[model samples]
Target: MISYLFGILSIKGKFEYFKMFLVLLSSLPNIDKRIKSIFQTIESVEDIVNIIIGGGAASLEKRASYSLEWLEQNGRCLDHIYSRLSDIPSAGRGAFSRRFIKKGEVVITSPLLAFQKSQLEEFYDKNNKIVPPPDFESRQVILNYCFSHPKSSLALFPLTHAMLINHASVRKGSNRHPNAKIRWATDHTETQKS
Candidate 1:
């Protein structure tokens, strides 16, 4: 799984970098004024970075949601894996899951792919009654395991944020960043109240 995640991120990173390079190249021909062009290039780079960050954040949120859904459905598989290994009475028993979950955490710190809404809905339907959310410490351990394994920071961040927000809202706090908070607050008071 770690390898798979890494493979995906590598491919994505290359594509994103390549796209930015091409965009930069395109602007090179239009820069008749060197100083102005330099500023333009800087602005272009900033725009690209912002796009990547925004897209990455969205992707991460989606992935986290999907991961939670997957866990809900496939928790039994995890339990089974633990049970089988521990029964062997070996010192290494239960170590694999713990290690895997830890690696997942690193992956979650980055951008993630989109979550499948239908899949999430299905999982929700299957588990109609709300169960207690998983423990934050344990959940974090699992996320750390996944994040560390293979995914890029750009791909895991949003997903991780989503999971943390959902499972441990009190701990995670608001999703809005400080910049967003100011904008939202100003808009709410000025427009909505008016």
Candidate 2:
């Protein structure tokens, strides 16, 4: 198969080479299946890639209607946020920056999971903090990714790379301070405003 492809590439005329290459590609077994799988991957992951890499819509409507559902079903953000083993002493996977992020710049636009505290009693501890999953002791804490107040029963959980961010532990003696901060997104279109 490789030899035939090389033969097609060696053809003298450009048009002839292209035509022969197309024919060779079509003759390859499972080519259609491979192509279909590629397109399926693109379709499933398009929205978040667009939002992260292409700066697609961050409107409340789009996040609530599309991004949030994708995250819930896929158990991952649709964006291009990459994760790897954390450099921290006890942490697991941590989100890393793909590009240089300027201070105060919006690095992520995530949708929130707002619900009453009682809705997640099984996940919370007596201190009102979320308990680490039994199987994931040193990973990012689910409660830290959420927003709750002493006076309010509602918790707003951000769904995006924001959830993947692990806090810098002062006890680790790293002396690093948080470089990013989460702020309300108020610039969404009027119809999509929260």
Candidate 3:
């Protein structure tokens, strides 16, 4: 699935058909520039095979890294690492781990949606207060999901399933405990040294 856009089954007239498909895809306004360039530069079936093989290799490497990370940290690995329930008592859909994840282990890694100080102005009114809900619900929603400093407008929100994890209670006698944590993944060179 990495390279074969739409599973080329037959090679009888695939070269011309694939070329035409690439031409159409390249012309798409939303297509990535690098992919568009690749599509435009393809010369033959061998080129397509090379691209497909290269993409498959990269995909496999990425999966291998993720599996290795999970194996090192959790002692086991599963392709789909999480499960979501439609409802959990009073709580809405909750993110649950499909496998037993070790304490302090990374559940999922995703980039943060960092909002600049100036860009966050849209969430505030002229008086510099957070806009009220209903009318400005979208802005309020963004503020709710994002982590922002009171003195600064900078906000960082995880762009993945991590957001679905339920917040633990801080009150006494509550059964919930903060079992998970979030941290900025600064290093991608390799998994952290044991």
Top candidate, metric TM-score: 2
Candidate 2 per-residue C-alpha lDDT over 68-178 given as tens digits, one digit per residue, 9 for 90 to 100: 666566343335445555676545445667777666877666656565655433343334454433223111133445677768976665534565566553443669566
TM-score order, best first, reads: 2, 3, 1
The lDDT of model 1 is: 0.28
Across 1-194, the per-residue lDDT of candidate 3 in tens digits comes to: 11222233242444554454444334433444533444455666655445343331222222223376675864422233443442336443345666777878877765445555354333333244554222233234445556678788676654344445665533335576676777766565454555
Rank all candidate structures by their lDDT, best first, as comma-separated numbers: 3, 2, 1
lDDT of all predictions = 0.28, 0.44, 0.46
- Candidate 2: lDDT of 25? 24
- Work out the TM-score per prediction: 0.16, 0.45, 0.44
Error of 3 at 135 (Å): 3.7
Better of 1 and 3 by lDDT: 3
- State model 2's lDDT: 0.44
Model 3 scores a TM of 0.44
Model 3 misplaced stretches (Cα beyond 4 Å) = 1-80, 83-91, 117-134, 169-173, 189-194
How displaced is residue 48 in candidate 1, in Å? 44
